[model samples]
Target: MWTNIQAKRPVWLAGAAIALAALAAYHNSFGGPFLFDDEQSILHNPSIRSFSTALTPPGGFGFTVSGRPLLNLSLALNYAVSGTEVWSYHALNLLIHVLAGLTLFGLVRRTLALPVLAGRFAGQELPAAFVIALLWTLHPLQTESVTYLIQRAESLMGLFYLLTLYGFVRAATAASARGWQVATVAACALGMACKEVMVTAPVVAVLYDRTFLAGSFRAAWERRRGLHAGLFATWLPLAWLVATAGGDRGGTFVLTPEAFAGYWLTQFEAVARYLQLALWPSPLVFEYGVTPVTAWTQVLPYAVPVVAAAGATLWALRFRPVAGFLGAAFFLILAPTSLLPGITQTIVEHRMYLPLAAVIALVAGAVMAALGRRVWPVLLVLALVAGGLTARRNADYQDEFRLWQDTVTKRPTSAKAQNNLGRVHFLRGELPEARQRYELAVSLDPGSAQTRYNLGLVLDATGQPEAAIAQYAEAVRILPYFAQARLRTASALLRLGRPAEAVAPAVEATRLLVEPAEAYFTLGQAQAMLGRPAEAAESYRAAVKHDPAQAEARLNLGIMLAQAGELAGAREQLGEAARLRPQLPEAHANLGIVLAESGRLPEAVASFQRALELRPDYAAAHYNLGNTLLRLGRVEEARGHFTAAVKAAPDFEAAREMLERLR
Candidate 1:
């Protein structure tokens, strides 16, 4: 609708309006919880808990291969203030999104100064800039970048990306004694730290020099020599940092130069896909997986739009946009992600967070220019309507459950969607329904580890421990260091009374990841079973150290201490276990046994009484209480408990004999 507002005052007002609209649209994100990979990337991570780990290359977020230190540093800063509050994490993401919007507005405004795109605005720089910024800020597709807290790396990186573009464009047009050169390069480096996407930024800088600074090929090359020397000089250190940080090479998928070229060509189709979505954003999904670039139907068919754009670029060699920044900036910033050899799959909504800004700006400015003097009202309507839609979409990200539920509802055949939705159901105790969804997902695609792991969890819950073990075994085999599968395998083993056999897998898990409290607890139980009481105690201690809520570990540790004759330590550990799990009938019953043996008869009787209070029909507690009373010389009381125990367990020889002795 934007084809009018070609004036400075109107543009300034539109910029302010976009700022307020974006802020209002996403304010609810302050309550969004950690979702999806946030668990592995942030919550369960040990390194992020401490400041020292924040600075290292493989730092601040545990020792995983994901060494985005700048991202870790931002998370570390978030942790320093509030560890896991949903509001704090969401607030940080919102701040980054809003700030990136502001930077995008600034970049657009600065681009208007260049001769190429400025003429399209018919001499009005401000109007074209406002329309671009307004649309970009309120686009519904960007909700993923803002609402998914962990993906703030994209939004935050975009801020620096736009800053680098603005400074470089201004430098090329103004040339100002090269003073801005250092700032431009520094911004580029920071952008790279924020995300590896900045690799495409240098290309954008050259395009700005070509289109705005000097358009002819020879002049652009001549102008680029000194800037290239200065720029690449700094990029050498950035390259080193990137190497130290490391990235997923798609495991042999990224090793080929031809594959890189194929990837770039495929992104041509991807760009067309993005354009299609911009026009009609239906059936959107947060995940598209590593979508294959050149499907048989898509290879020939998708080339139509890409070919058109390419031909347009060739023909438009004589006539360029006034800002001159849109084509090169869009192409430049987008190239690393869209053209990279191997990284993510071919399509993801989050990838659009930065590039869409350029595309939207180009479209909005061009639309306003074409309408000639009536675009202001239309721009306002577009911002308001888009902002409303974006706000509506963000409501889906309120929780993982809601997000995936929406996904499955929108894309019923999407196996990933079904699997994630099943995970939400499983987390909330709808086991039967979760199993139903997981089975559907498996039927759709058996290759996904996430689906298999989820199905394993359901099987384990339904008492099919052996089947669950098999599922987890397969998952771990596929992804050897996958912490979830390894932990589940150990848990199933423990449940099947094969805890001793679980030691190997649990050890493997710890060697790979210093997390999984359940694994450590299960390992301790297995060690204790193998006659390694001392080692078991240390394992239990580590388990409780990582997760203070491990009451079972504490009680087990206490029992081992009692058996080892460490009476004081046994009582201390058991007492803590009791305090932690008041309803644990075994904890109270065991406490009574330890106390009676320690010569605390009155305390022993009371502990037994409490165990009875919690679980009145507990046969073991009745049997143990009967024995404790017998030791205390309460013959009558002992007989009563013995009678109850025998009634509770009809095959109880111990209760029958104990009652006979009392008589």
Candidate 2:
């Protein structure tokens, strides 16, 4: 019934349907808050703060944008336009998805219309391609790439990947193939910049050439050697980016033979799980984590079938090239992430972003072949169902709390999920809930430094300084470069008044943290607590050097300077502290002491008055004001302040002595 209607429709109409379906599926996702990697890649990424450094993403941080300069630059564009509003990022993600869908539609339609397969698809290419594109775009499994924000690295690369193939198909068929070939290379290069997954694109392009255009690899290479060369050349930039990005994509890659073997052994189950989700799309997890199946017995059941399918794909390359291309493309697209051991993530749905295309194409072709003219209604129903599921999945991403909660519910054993959920609770000020979650996460993954640090935060917030320090110490012991943990350990020690213990961690924190002002300030406090005035003053000076606006550090520096007989330096720091924190009475009181010692009696009186104005009952300020007044020969005023000082502090022996002498 609908075959007749679909046959009458042009490709643009089909594209419009795909676009509308994508929009409907993700309309609720525009308001979705940034989650997980988004915080590092988008929110805190200084590289995205300016266009000048857009191509030079922050490295050594394992950020999502670390090695993907194009992804980082794209985020910079979003940052320039909207800062951290998040809606702009989501909008760009949807645009990339829609563009990818349209590209897929064009690629499929044109591929079907090729002379080789035209006899079978004939007039139904538009509808068949539309079904594939629409279903793939609306698949609930894609919510991770579309709705999770930072995973734009996946969808953006997927777009360029499709364009590369689409452009190649056009180049093969066009009368003047030069422009299409260049566009194909450009797309491939851009894809490489988007993600390492694009390394498979060049291989996939060659495979497509062999399957559809050229009869064999030798013929395809001979005919389009230049195009293939250009495609492979793009790998140079990708290689350089990866190498310069700490050669490990920010420590995600684990290249040891044992790690590789374990990760590879786990891929059989991961691939099976991906296929299951592609078919069922239920209980989609945000993060599967980096747990590897070291024992072959655990994955043996999946390994047998997966190995068989791989062997069958190899065999089919000679006899059934088209079927082999689809199978190989799926496996090849997944091979980089699957074969390479990424210590950060093992099984993620977003890794299936492009590979899902091959799966859909295979399934759609089989369904179309089976149902023929009756396939239109079935495809339409599937598209609607997929769209509804996608929308429902996107709802889980509306807030970090909901997303992590959903992930924890689905993957109860995932320590990463529990940690992220605890982070959400921590941010919301739900200390008890956050503490419970963090404790569970720590117990689940005792070796996770990040979880340990997070548990420390919850412990510290709940007033358990010793426990917090223990967790922080464990975190730094595990990941020595963890600057924040080092700083937190020192802070917790200082909280317990263990200045000697705090000094070493505080000093290490100063060396490890990028912004070490807080560490230096904490170190100054520790030094002052231990009666090391000179060292304390130097630390405070270093803190002020890093952050000139730190009022507390300035106040501490002033006190140290005054005690060390640097009256002029003390006065300057105290004045700046008062300016920086006008509401702080301590700043004014310290400045008064420095001024009095500097022989500026009038200024000292005014400073004491300012301190008393901010805090009328400040005992120290009253006593200091009394001393300054007495020096200025204002005996009655001095007597009144001495009385007020004694009232503010009944145990003020110095004020009582002065009062008695005055009497």
State which candidate has the highest lDDT: 2
Q: Write the per-residue lDDT of candidate 1 for residues 515-539, one digit (tens) a residue.
A: 6577788789888878899999988
In model 1, where is the ten-residue run with the lowest total lDDT?
57-66
- On TM-score, the leading prediction is 2
Residue 644 of model 1 has an lDDT of 90
Give the Cα error of residue 582 in candidate 1, in Å: 2.8
lDDT of prediction 2 = 0.89
Give the Cα lDDT of each candidate: 0.74, 0.89
TM-score of each: 0.87, 0.88
Candidate 1: C-alpha RMSD to true structure equals 4.7
lDDT of 2 by residue, 120-237 (tens): 7757887888889888999999989989899999999999999999999999999999999999999999999999999999899999999999888999999999999999999999
Task: After the best TM-score superposition of candidate 2, give how far the Cα of residue 204 lies from its true spot, in angstroms.
Answer: 1.0
Where is model 1 more than 4 Å wrong at Cα? 1-15, 55-65, 80-82, 115-123, 169-182, 214-242, 249-269, 293-295, 314-325, 341-344, 399-402, 600-602, 620-639, 650-658
Per-model C-alpha RMSD = 4.7, 4.3
Per-residue lDDT, model 1, residue 567, is 83
